[model samples]
Target: MRFTAPVDGEPVGAAITAEPLEDHFGAHSALESALMAAFDNGRNPIRSVCAESIDQNGGKGVVLHSGLFRVDGMEPDRGITA
Candidate 1:
Protein backbone atom coordinates (compact mmCIF):
# COMPACT_ATOMS: atom_id res chain seq x y z
CA MET A 1 0.00 0.00 0.00
CA ARG A 2 1.10 3.50 -0.79
CA PHE A 3 -0.06 6.65 0.88
CA THR A 4 0.51 10.24 -0.07
CA ALA A 5 1.20 13.03 2.31
CA PRO A 6 -1.97 15.00 2.75
CA VAL A 7 -0.28 18.37 2.56
CA ASP A 8 2.37 17.96 -0.13
CA GLY A 9 0.96 15.12 -2.24
CA GLU A 10 4.27 13.28 -1.97
CA PRO A 11 4.44 9.71 -0.85
CA VAL A 12 4.69 9.64 2.92
CA GLY A 13 4.75 5.93 3.50
CA ALA A 14 4.26 2.52 1.93
CA ALA A 15 3.54 -1.00 3.07
CA ILE A 16 5.65 -3.78 1.71
CA THR A 17 6.37 -7.37 2.58
CA ALA A 18 7.80 -10.58 1.26
CA GLU A 19 6.31 -14.01 1.13
CA PRO A 20 7.32 -16.23 4.04
CA LEU A 21 9.89 -18.79 3.03
CA GLU A 22 10.70 -21.96 4.88
CA ASP A 23 14.42 -21.44 4.52
CA HIS A 24 14.24 -18.02 6.25
CA PHE A 25 17.75 -17.22 5.21
CA GLY A 26 18.54 -13.74 3.93
CA ALA A 27 14.94 -12.69 4.31
CA HIS A 28 15.86 -9.67 6.39
CA SER A 29 18.49 -8.54 3.93
CA ALA A 30 16.09 -9.04 1.05
CA LEU A 31 13.44 -6.96 2.71
CA GLU A 32 15.91 -4.25 3.47
CA SER A 33 17.04 -4.25 -0.14
CA ALA A 34 13.49 -3.91 -1.33
CA LEU A 35 13.01 -0.96 0.99
CA MET A 36 16.15 0.72 -0.27
CA ALA A 37 15.00 0.22 -3.82
CA ALA A 38 11.73 1.89 -3.05
CA PHE A 39 13.48 4.86 -1.55
CA ASP A 40 16.08 5.06 -4.27
CA ASN A 41 13.74 4.70 -7.22
CA GLY A 42 13.64 8.51 -7.55
CA ARG A 43 9.98 8.52 -8.45
CA ASN A 44 7.91 9.21 -5.37
CA PRO A 45 9.38 11.23 -2.56
CA ILE A 46 8.62 8.84 0.22
CA ARG A 47 9.07 10.23 3.70
CA SER A 48 8.45 7.04 5.61
CA VAL A 49 7.37 3.40 5.37
CA CYS A 50 5.23 1.12 7.45
CA ALA A 51 4.68 -2.58 8.12
CA GLU A 52 2.60 -4.70 10.46
CA SER A 53 2.99 -7.95 12.31
CA ILE A 54 1.66 -9.67 15.36
CA ASP A 55 2.96 -8.32 18.66
CA GLN A 56 4.49 -11.67 19.45
CA ASN A 57 6.72 -11.53 16.37
CA GLY A 58 9.89 -10.29 18.02
CA GLY A 59 12.09 -11.02 15.03
CA LYS A 60 9.93 -9.06 12.64
CA GLY A 61 9.72 -6.24 15.14
CA VAL A 62 13.47 -6.15 15.37
CA VAL A 63 13.86 -6.06 11.61
CA LEU A 64 11.21 -3.41 11.15
CA HIS A 65 12.77 -1.15 13.71
CA SER A 66 16.35 -2.04 12.96
CA GLY A 67 17.25 0.02 9.93
CA LEU A 68 14.50 2.43 8.90
CA PHE A 69 11.48 1.92 11.09
CA ARG A 70 10.43 2.89 14.60
CA VAL A 71 7.52 2.24 16.85
CA ASP A 72 4.94 4.87 15.98
CA GLY A 73 1.74 3.73 17.60
CA MET A 74 -0.17 0.60 18.28
CA GLU A 75 -3.80 -0.18 17.73
CA PRO A 76 -4.57 -2.43 20.61
CA ASP A 77 -6.78 -5.35 19.71
CA ARG A 78 -6.53 -4.41 16.09
CA GLY A 79 -8.54 -6.87 14.00
CA ILE A 80 -9.47 -8.66 17.17
CA THR A 81 -12.24 -8.60 19.73
CA ALA A 82 -12.60 -9.34 23.41
Candidate 2:
Protein backbone atom coordinates (compact mmCIF):
# COMPACT_ATOMS: atom_id res chain seq x y z
CA MET A 1 0.00 0.00 0.00
CA ARG A 2 1.09 3.57 -0.66
CA PHE A 3 0.78 6.25 2.06
CA THR A 4 1.22 9.96 1.60
CA ALA A 5 1.24 12.72 4.19
CA PRO A 6 -0.03 16.20 3.43
CA VAL A 7 2.24 19.04 2.41
CA ASP A 8 1.99 20.92 5.72
CA GLY A 9 4.46 18.93 7.72
CA GLU A 10 8.08 17.83 7.50
CA PRO A 11 8.61 15.23 4.84
CA VAL A 12 5.16 16.18 3.71
CA GLY A 13 3.53 14.49 0.80
CA ALA A 14 6.04 11.74 1.05
CA ALA A 15 4.96 8.38 -0.13
CA ILE A 16 5.35 5.64 2.43
CA THR A 17 5.41 2.02 1.39
CA ALA A 18 4.47 -1.19 3.12
CA GLU A 19 6.34 -4.22 1.92
CA PRO A 20 4.01 -7.17 1.56
CA LEU A 21 5.45 -9.64 4.03
CA GLU A 22 4.44 -12.27 6.48
CA ASP A 23 5.52 -10.22 9.48
CA HIS A 24 3.20 -7.36 8.61
CA PHE A 25 0.28 -9.65 8.03
CA GLY A 26 0.99 -11.37 11.34
CA ALA A 27 1.08 -8.12 13.24
CA HIS A 28 -2.16 -7.04 11.64
CA SER A 29 -3.83 -10.30 12.43
CA ALA A 30 -2.72 -10.13 16.05
CA LEU A 31 -4.05 -6.61 16.37
CA GLU A 32 -7.38 -7.62 14.91
CA SER A 33 -7.65 -10.52 17.33
CA ALA A 34 -6.97 -8.18 20.21
CA LEU A 35 -9.50 -5.73 18.92
CA MET A 36 -12.12 -8.43 18.64
CA ALA A 37 -11.40 -9.53 22.16
CA ALA A 38 -11.77 -5.96 23.34
CA PHE A 39 -15.14 -5.84 21.61
CA ASP A 40 -16.15 -9.02 23.35
CA ASN A 41 -15.38 -7.23 26.61
CA GLY A 42 -17.77 -4.44 25.60
CA ARG A 43 -15.15 -2.19 24.10
CA ASN A 44 -15.26 -0.82 20.58
CA PRO A 45 -12.46 -1.45 18.14
CA ILE A 46 -10.49 1.73 17.78
CA ARG A 47 -10.12 1.28 14.01
CA SER A 48 -11.32 -0.97 11.22
CA VAL A 49 -9.46 -4.15 10.34
CA CYS A 50 -8.21 -2.77 7.01
CA ALA A 51 -6.90 0.31 8.75
CA GLU A 52 -5.10 -2.00 11.12
CA SER A 53 -3.53 -3.56 8.06
CA ILE A 54 -2.09 -0.19 7.16
CA ASP A 55 -0.85 0.07 10.70
CA GLN A 56 1.10 -3.14 10.61
CA ASN A 57 2.53 -2.01 7.32
CA GLY A 58 4.37 1.21 8.29
CA GLY A 59 2.05 4.21 8.33
CA LYS A 60 1.01 3.42 11.89
CA GLY A 61 -2.56 3.69 10.62
CA VAL A 62 -4.99 6.35 11.93
CA VAL A 63 -2.56 7.66 14.49
CA LEU A 64 -0.63 9.60 11.87
CA HIS A 65 -3.85 11.00 10.46
CA SER A 66 -5.20 11.90 13.89
CA GLY A 67 -2.06 13.76 14.83
CA LEU A 68 -2.12 15.71 11.62
CA PHE A 69 -5.82 16.52 11.62
CA ARG A 70 -6.46 16.92 15.35
CA VAL A 71 -10.22 16.62 14.84
CA ASP A 72 -10.82 18.43 18.16
CA GLY A 73 -7.93 20.82 17.49
CA MET A 74 -6.01 19.70 20.56
CA GLU A 75 -2.53 18.29 20.91
CA PRO A 76 -1.93 15.19 22.99
CA ASP A 77 0.36 16.74 25.54
CA ARG A 78 0.18 14.10 28.22
CA GLY A 79 1.29 11.40 25.83
CA ILE A 80 0.53 7.76 26.57
CA THR A 81 0.28 7.08 30.28
CA ALA A 82 1.40 3.54 29.90
Candidate 3:
Protein backbone atom coordinates (compact mmCIF):
# COMPACT_ATOMS: atom_id res chain seq x y z
CA MET A 1 0.00 0.00 0.00
CA ARG A 2 1.13 3.55 -0.71
CA PHE A 3 1.49 6.20 2.00
CA THR A 4 -0.10 9.61 2.02
CA ALA A 5 0.12 12.86 3.97
CA PRO A 6 -2.36 13.09 6.83
CA VAL A 7 -2.67 16.81 6.31
CA ASP A 8 -4.65 18.39 3.49
CA GLY A 9 -3.53 20.70 0.63
CA GLU A 10 0.03 19.41 0.80
CA PRO A 11 1.05 16.92 -1.86
CA VAL A 12 0.62 13.28 -0.96
CA GLY A 13 3.71 11.40 0.19
CA ALA A 14 5.65 14.67 0.40
CA ALA A 15 8.60 14.21 2.81
CA ILE A 16 10.94 16.70 4.48
CA THR A 17 14.67 16.59 5.15
CA ALA A 18 17.46 18.76 6.61
CA GLU A 19 21.24 19.03 6.23
CA PRO A 20 21.72 17.11 9.50
CA LEU A 21 19.95 14.13 11.00
CA GLU A 22 16.25 14.60 11.57
CA ASP A 23 16.50 14.26 15.33
CA HIS A 24 15.01 16.28 18.18
CA PHE A 25 17.94 18.67 18.20
CA GLY A 26 17.70 19.50 14.48
CA ALA A 27 13.91 19.73 14.49
CA HIS A 28 13.67 21.91 17.59
CA SER A 29 16.37 24.20 16.31
CA ALA A 30 14.27 24.96 13.20
CA LEU A 31 11.34 26.13 15.34
CA GLU A 32 13.27 28.28 17.83
CA SER A 33 14.57 30.42 14.99
CA ALA A 34 11.08 31.03 13.67
CA LEU A 35 9.76 32.23 17.01
CA MET A 36 12.75 34.49 17.51
CA ALA A 37 12.00 36.12 14.16
CA ALA A 38 8.37 36.64 15.14
CA PHE A 39 9.46 38.42 18.29
CA ASP A 40 12.42 40.29 16.82
CA ASN A 41 10.71 41.75 13.75
CA GLY A 42 7.30 41.47 15.40
CA ARG A 43 5.94 39.64 12.35
CA ASN A 44 5.29 35.92 12.61
CA PRO A 45 7.19 34.44 9.74
CA ILE A 46 5.60 31.98 7.36
CA ARG A 47 7.90 29.00 7.71
CA SER A 48 7.03 26.46 4.99
CA VAL A 49 9.72 23.89 5.56
CA CYS A 50 7.89 20.63 6.21
CA ALA A 51 10.15 17.62 6.13
CA GLU A 52 10.10 13.86 6.76
CA SER A 53 12.03 10.65 6.11
CA ILE A 54 11.70 6.88 5.70
CA ASP A 55 13.52 3.68 6.65
CA GLN A 56 14.73 0.68 4.65
CA ASN A 57 11.25 -0.77 4.19
CA GLY A 58 9.81 2.72 3.83
CA GLY A 59 7.62 1.84 6.80
CA LYS A 60 9.31 3.68 9.61
CA GLY A 61 8.57 7.40 9.22
CA VAL A 62 9.69 10.69 10.79
CA VAL A 63 8.00 13.99 10.05
CA LEU A 64 9.33 17.53 10.67
CA HIS A 65 6.62 20.22 10.76
CA SER A 66 8.21 23.50 11.66
CA GLY A 67 10.01 23.39 15.02
CA LEU A 68 12.74 25.52 16.61
CA PHE A 69 14.26 26.65 13.31
CA ARG A 70 18.04 27.12 13.06
CA VAL A 71 18.11 28.39 9.50
CA ASP A 72 19.03 31.77 8.11
CA GLY A 73 16.84 34.95 7.74
CA MET A 74 16.18 35.03 11.48
CA GLU A 75 19.33 36.12 13.24
CA PRO A 76 18.50 35.48 16.86
CA ASP A 77 19.47 38.14 19.41
CA ARG A 78 20.53 36.11 22.40
CA GLY A 79 21.58 39.37 24.06
CA ILE A 80 17.91 40.37 24.29
CA THR A 81 14.64 38.56 25.03
CA ALA A 82 11.05 38.92 23.77
Candidate 4:
Protein backbone atom coordinates (compact mmCIF):
# COMPACT_ATOMS: atom_id res chain seq x y z
CA MET A 1 0.00 0.00 0.00
CA ARG A 2 1.00 3.62 -0.56
CA PHE A 3 1.68 5.81 2.48
CA THR A 4 1.88 9.54 2.95
CA ALA A 5 3.22 11.58 5.83
CA PRO A 6 1.31 14.20 7.75
CA VAL A 7 1.38 17.79 6.57
CA ASP A 8 4.09 18.38 9.10
CA GLY A 9 6.18 15.77 7.25
CA GLU A 10 6.61 13.52 10.22
CA PRO A 11 7.31 9.90 9.40
CA VAL A 12 4.31 7.61 9.62
CA GLY A 13 3.67 4.03 8.68
CA ALA A 14 0.50 2.30 7.55
CA ALA A 15 -0.84 -1.09 6.68
CA ILE A 16 -3.72 -2.09 4.42
CA THR A 17 -5.39 -5.40 3.79
CA ALA A 18 -8.44 -6.88 2.11
CA GLU A 19 -10.38 -10.05 2.84
CA PRO A 20 -13.85 -11.56 2.82
CA LEU A 21 -15.84 -11.96 6.00
CA GLU A 22 -19.04 -13.73 6.94
CA ASP A 23 -20.62 -10.50 8.16
CA HIS A 24 -19.96 -7.06 9.54
CA PHE A 25 -18.83 -8.54 12.81
CA GLY A 26 -16.21 -10.60 11.08
CA ALA A 27 -15.16 -7.63 9.07
CA HIS A 28 -14.69 -5.72 12.28
CA SER A 29 -12.39 -8.42 13.51
CA ALA A 30 -10.31 -8.28 10.37
CA LEU A 31 -10.07 -4.52 10.56
CA GLU A 32 -9.08 -4.63 14.18
CA SER A 33 -6.38 -7.12 13.43
CA ALA A 34 -4.97 -4.88 10.78
CA LEU A 35 -5.09 -1.87 13.04
CA MET A 36 -3.34 -3.70 15.82
CA ALA A 37 -0.62 -4.78 13.50
CA ALA A 38 -0.20 -1.28 12.23
CA PHE A 39 0.11 0.24 15.67
CA ASP A 40 2.16 -2.53 17.15
CA ASN A 41 4.71 -2.41 14.36
CA GLY A 42 3.88 0.69 12.38
CA ARG A 43 6.09 3.79 12.40
CA ASN A 44 3.28 6.10 13.41
CA PRO A 45 3.28 7.19 17.04
CA ILE A 46 0.48 6.97 19.56
CA ARG A 47 -2.58 9.23 19.04
CA SER A 48 -1.76 9.54 15.39
CA VAL A 49 -4.66 9.47 12.98
CA CYS A 50 -5.10 6.13 11.30
CA ALA A 51 -7.63 4.81 8.86
CA GLU A 52 -9.16 1.48 7.91
CA SER A 53 -11.43 0.27 5.14
CA ILE A 54 -13.90 -2.56 5.45
CA ASP A 55 -15.58 -4.45 2.65
CA GLN A 56 -18.95 -6.05 3.12
CA ASN A 57 -19.26 -9.75 2.63
CA GLY A 58 -19.94 -11.21 -0.83
CA GLY A 59 -18.72 -8.17 -2.70
CA LYS A 60 -21.54 -5.96 -1.47
CA GLY A 61 -19.52 -2.74 -1.00
CA VAL A 62 -16.87 -1.03 1.06
CA VAL A 63 -16.97 1.53 3.86
CA LEU A 64 -14.07 3.97 3.74
CA HIS A 65 -13.24 6.73 6.21
CA SER A 66 -10.67 7.96 8.70
CA GLY A 67 -11.48 8.18 12.41
CA LEU A 68 -9.20 5.72 14.13
CA PHE A 69 -6.73 7.12 16.63
CA ARG A 70 -3.87 5.02 17.90
CA VAL A 71 -3.72 4.49 21.63
CA ASP A 72 -2.21 1.89 23.87
CA GLY A 73 -4.48 -0.73 25.43
CA MET A 74 -7.68 0.65 24.00
CA GLU A 75 -10.00 0.27 21.04
CA PRO A 76 -10.10 2.70 18.17
CA ASP A 77 -13.06 4.97 17.66
CA ARG A 78 -15.79 3.82 15.26
CA GLY A 79 -15.63 6.51 12.66
CA ILE A 80 -17.85 7.05 9.65
CA THR A 81 -18.43 3.73 7.94
CA ALA A 82 -20.47 2.94 4.90
On TM-score, the leading prediction is 4
Predicted candidate 4 versus true structure: per-residue lDDT over 1-82, tens digit per residue:
2344332344444333333121211334546665445434533322333322211122222222222232332224334366
TM-score of candidate 3 to 2 decimals: 0.19
lDDT of 3 by residue, 1-82 (tens): 1224433344445333332223322333446464343333422221122222222225343443334244442222223466
Q: Quote model 4's TM-score.
A: 0.22
What lDDT score is found at residue 66 in candidate 2?
A: 26
User: Could you tell me the lDDT of residue 79 within candidate 1?
Assistant: 40
- Between candidates 2 and 3, the lDDT winner: 3
Instruction: By lDDT, rank the candidates, best first.
Output: 3, 4, 1, 2
**Pairwise TM-score winner, candidates 2 and 4:** 4
**Lowest summed lDDT window (length 10), candidate 3:** 43-52
1-82: candidate 1 lDDT, tens digit per residue: 2333332333333333332111111233456565445444522212222323322342132222232332334332234567
**If scored against the real structure, what TM-score would every candidate get?**
0.19, 0.20, 0.19, 0.22
Error of 4 at 3 (Å): 2.1
**lDDT preference between candidates 2 and 4, better one:** 4
- lDDT of candidate model 4 versus the reference: 0.33
Structural RMSD, model 1: 11.5
The whole-model C-alpha lDDT of candidate 2 against the native structure comes to 0.30
The global C-alpha lDDT for each of the candidates, from Candidate 1 onward, is: 0.32, 0.30, 0.33, 0.33
Report the error of model 2 at residue 1, Å.
2.3
Number of colliding residue pairs in each model: 0, 0, 14, 0
